[model samples]
Target: MDALKILIIPGSARDGSFNRRLAEFAARQARAAGQEATLLDLRALNLPLYDADLEALSGVPAGALRLQQAIQASDAVLLVTPEYNGFPTPLVINAFDWLSRIPATQEQPAGLAVTANKPAGLLSASPGAGGALRSMNFLRQYLQMAFAMVVVPQQFALGRAHEAFDATGALQDPRAVQSVETVLQSLARLAQALKTA
Candidate 1:
């Protein structure tokens, strides 16, 4: 198969966030599988809250524009989110809100340019046993509304995520690693098929 470009986005901005670790691990795994992976951290982006007034005055922020370009360029997206009281973190929601507002261009319709028809993999990690599963549900729904082609019925939710990794930030559980690999492989295959179609 052709080398796929995959974008890994982490939901949290905390310095020692488990979600960030999960995203990095996934990115490493993707590279090991012969795909090009780019990891994007929401905190570094420093995006403003979504507002119509701000957009009307200045258009999409530079950070959001950069993110939109990254999404458009990638063959697939993997979202590593954390649960905030049974919902996706604010950072993830804010970034998507900005990305969703990118105006329509000659190449594609409004919003669709960045996300429509693109293969997406959803994963979530939490310290608790539930593994941010609720957050994944919300994320899946949001991505669907954004017109993304979500790879369903195979999402990964890493329960007890705080203890799932080693000091080197490598995933310790073989099952979790295998699940992540399966999700990445599935995304690559689906993305390739869609690209050729």
Candidate 2:
């Protein structure tokens, strides 16, 4: 009877990224639904790009390991990404790569089992019209490789992200809010299904 733990991953490294704000909004919605939501800012993590040279010299960066630990602990993930060069930032992909390199662990006895039946909800945004759809497409595939149970039917690609939030960091779009709510609800149901099945 534990609360669901969801991690909000902001894809941008910008200090005031609108995508990050979107993640915040999603976290609030998930938390309001009786889940425990935490933010993991890519900018704040500041991890060195995944490097084979570094891995050979040092096992895994403490920061990287810390992120992996968090990934291990969480019950689900929410990715809020922005379209960059028609895709998400390299930082977000790097975060995934680093987490994947943790070696097949008991927490992950197998790739699928390692996640402990965690789920993921994807969201994307952009100032440009298409709304980061291409970037989200790539992220969706990446979730599969991580063995995450992705929530469908609520995929959100919020457009004109800058206009979607206020100075106080509140979400302004009712559609975007509703989309986030739907995704969170689906995530909850997916988690429940994974636990039982």
Q: Number of clashes in every candidate structure?
A: 0, 1
lDDT tens readout by residue for model 2, 69-101: 677678777788987788778988887676666
Top TM-score model: 1
Q: Report the error of model 1 at residue 118, Å.
A: 0.4
Clashing pairs in 2: 108-114
Angstrom error at residue 91, model 1: 0.6
The lDDT values for all models are 0.86, 0.76
Best by lDDT: 1
Give the runs in model 2 whose Cα sits over 4 Å from its true position: 104-113, 146-153
Which residue pairs of candidate 1 clash? none
Error of 2 at 58 (Å): 1.2
- Tens digits of per-residue lDDT, candidate 1, 13-87, equal 788999989999999989998999999877787799999999999988878777887888899999999999999
Which 10 consecutive positions of candidate 2 have the poorest summed lDDT? 108-117
